[model samples]
Target: MKVFGICGYSGSGKTTLLEAMIALLTARGLKVSLIKHAHHGFDIDKPGKDSWRHREAGAGEIALITDKRWVLMHEARNEEPPQLVDILERLSPCDLVLLEGFKRAVHPKIEVHRPSLGKPPVWPEDCDIVAVASDQAIDCALPRLDLNDPEQVADFVLKHVGLK
Candidate 1:
C-alpha cells in the first residue's frame, strides 16, 4: 500500500488531525488502513469479557469475530514488539495506509507541530518528514500547512505524497 505518516509530540493534535483527514480521505472513495503506535500498555477487552479471560489465560492470539467486525489480538508475551514492516506484511492491500506513529521509519511523513507544545519539530533531525502542519507560520524549506484546516491539509498531503 502507499503509506504516509502523521507524527508529532503528545497533545499536538496528531490524532485529531488524522481523524479529520480520514473522513475526508474516505469520502473521496479511497480505502485507508491505519497502524498506530502506543508507547504504554493498552487493552481493548473489558475486564469481565471472555476475550479478556482468554488472553489472561495466556492465549497466544485471539480472534473475536462478529457480523459487523473482527478483531485479532496477538499477545507478544516475552517476545519483542513486532516491527512496522512485519505488521504491514499482514495487512490486506489498500489505497493507502496512514500510519500515526513509527516516526523513525523511512516512510514519508507530515509533522504536526503546535508551537505552544514547547517542543521542537522532528523534521530537522529526520529527513523523512516531508512537510509540517502547524498553527503558526514558520520558516522552513518544506511546505507548511495550516493544522486547523483539515481540508487544506488533506489536499496538501495528497499533493505532497503524489496521491490522487
Candidate 2:
C-alpha cells in the first residue's frame, strides 16, 4: 500500500488535517487507512470495558471484535516499541495509508506548520518531507499548501505518492 505521513509540532493541526483528508478521500471512493503515533500514554479501552478488564488481568495481547470493527491491543511489557513498518503491516488493505507522527521514519511526508507553535520546521533536517501544509505562505524549497484546504492537499499527496 502507498503510505504517506504528516509530521509537526503539537497543536499544528495535524489531526484536523488528517480528519479532513480522510473525509475527502473516502468520499472519492478511495480506501484510506490511518495510523497514528502517540507519545506519552494512550488508552482506547476504558476501565469498565471488557478489553480493559482483559488487559488488567494480564493478557499480553487482546483482540476485541465486533461486526464492523476490531481492535488489537498489545502490551509493551519491556519489549522494544514496534517499528513503523511492523505497525503498518497490521492495517487492513487499502489504497493508501495516512500516518500521523513517526517523523523519524523514512517515509515521504508533509510537514504541518504553524508559526504559533514556536517550533522549527522538520523539513530543513528531513529531506523526506516533500510538502508543507501551512496557514501562511513561506519561502521554502518544498511546495506550500493551505492547512485548511484538505481536498487540495489530499490531491497533492495522492499525486506525489502515486496513489491516484
Candidate 3:
C-alpha cells in the first residue's frame, strides 16, 4: 500500500485533518488503513474483563472477538516499541496507509500545522515532509495547503504519493 504520514505537535489538528482525509479517501473508493503512534501507556482491556484476566495470567497476546469487531492485543513486555516497518508488515494490503504518528520515521509525510499553536513547521527540519497543511500562510517552498480545506490537502497527498 502507498504510505503517507500526518504529523504535528499536540492539538495542532493532525487528527482533524486525518479524519477529513479518511472520509474523502474512502469516498473515492480507496481502501485505507491507518497506523497511529501513542506515547503514553495505554490499555484496551479493562480491569475484571476476561481479556484482562487472561493477560494478567501471563498471556502474551489476547484476542477479543465479538460480532462487530475483533481486537488483538500483544504485550510488548521487555521489548521496545516495534519499528514502523515492523507494524506495517502486519497490516493487510490496502490502496493506501495513512500514518498519523511516527514523526521520526523516514517516510513521505504531510506536516499538519496550526499557526495558532505557535510552533514552526516540521518541513524545513524534516526533509521527509513532502507538503505542509496549515491554518496560516507559510513561506515554505514546498507544496502548501489550507488546513481548513481537507479536500485540498487530500488532493495534495494523492498527488504527492503518485496516486492521483
Candidate 4:
C-alpha cells in the first residue's frame, strides 16, 4: 500500500483534514486506512470494560470483537512506541494509508500549519515535508493548499502516492 502522512502541531487541524480525506477517499471507492500517533497517554477501554480489566490484569494484548467492530489493545508497559514499519505490518492491505503524526518518521508528508497557533512551520526543519496545507498562503517551495479544502488535499495525496 502507498503511504502518506499529515503532520502538524496541536490545533492546526490535522485531525479535521484526515477526517475529510478519509471520507472523500472512501466515497471515491478507494480502500484507505489510517495510523495515528498520540503523544499523551490515551485509553480506548473504560475501567469497567472487560478489555480494560484484562489490560489492568497485565495482559500484553487484549482483543475484543463483535459483529460491528473489533479492537485490539496492547499494553505498552512503559515500552517505547512501536516503530512505523511495525505498525504498518499490523494493518491490513489498503490502496492508501494516511498517517497522522509520526512527524519524525521518514515518510513523505504534508505539514498542516495554522499561523494563529503561534508555532512556526515544521517544514523549515523537516525535510520529509513534501508540501504544506495552511489557512493562509506563504512563500513556500512546495505546493500549498487551503487547509479547509480537503478535496484538493486529498487529490494532492493521491497524486503524491501515484494512485491517480
> Which portions of model 3 show Cα errors greater than 4 Å?
none
Candidates in order have lDDT scores of 0.91, 0.92, 0.89, 0.93
lDDT of 1 at 93: 93
lDDT of 2 by residue, 1-164 (tens): 99999999989999999999999999999999998899989888899888899899999999988999887899998899999889888888999999999998899999999977778888999999999999987878999999989988999999998877
Return the TM-score for each candidate structure: 0.96, 0.95, 0.96, 0.96
Instruction: Give the per-residue lDDT of model 4 (tens digit) for 108-134.
Output: 999999988889889989999999999
Please write out the lDDT profile of model 1 over residues 1-164, one tens digit for every residue: 78899999999998999999999999999888999999899989999899999999999999999999999999999999999999899999988888997888889999998888899889899999989999999877899999999999888778766785
Residue 129 CA error for candidate 1 (Å)? 0.5
Q: Residue 93 in candidate 2 has what lDDT? A: 93
Model 1 TM: 0.96
Residue 153 CA displacement from its true place in model 4, Å = 0.5
Determine which window of 10 residues in candidate 3 has minimal summed lDDT.
113-122
Q: In order, how many clashes per candidate?
A: 0, 0, 0, 0
Measured over all alpha carbons after superposition, the RMSD of each candidate to the real structure, in angstroms, is 1.0, 1.1, 1.0, 1.0
Q: Can you write out model 3's per-residue Cα lDDT over 17-126, one digit (the tens) per residue?
A: 89999999999999999999988888987999888999999999898889998888999989888899998999999989999978889999988888888887778899
Q: Which residue window of length 10 is worst by lDDT in model 2? A: 114-123
Best lDDT among the predictions, by candidate number: 4
* Winner of 2 and 3 under lDDT: 2
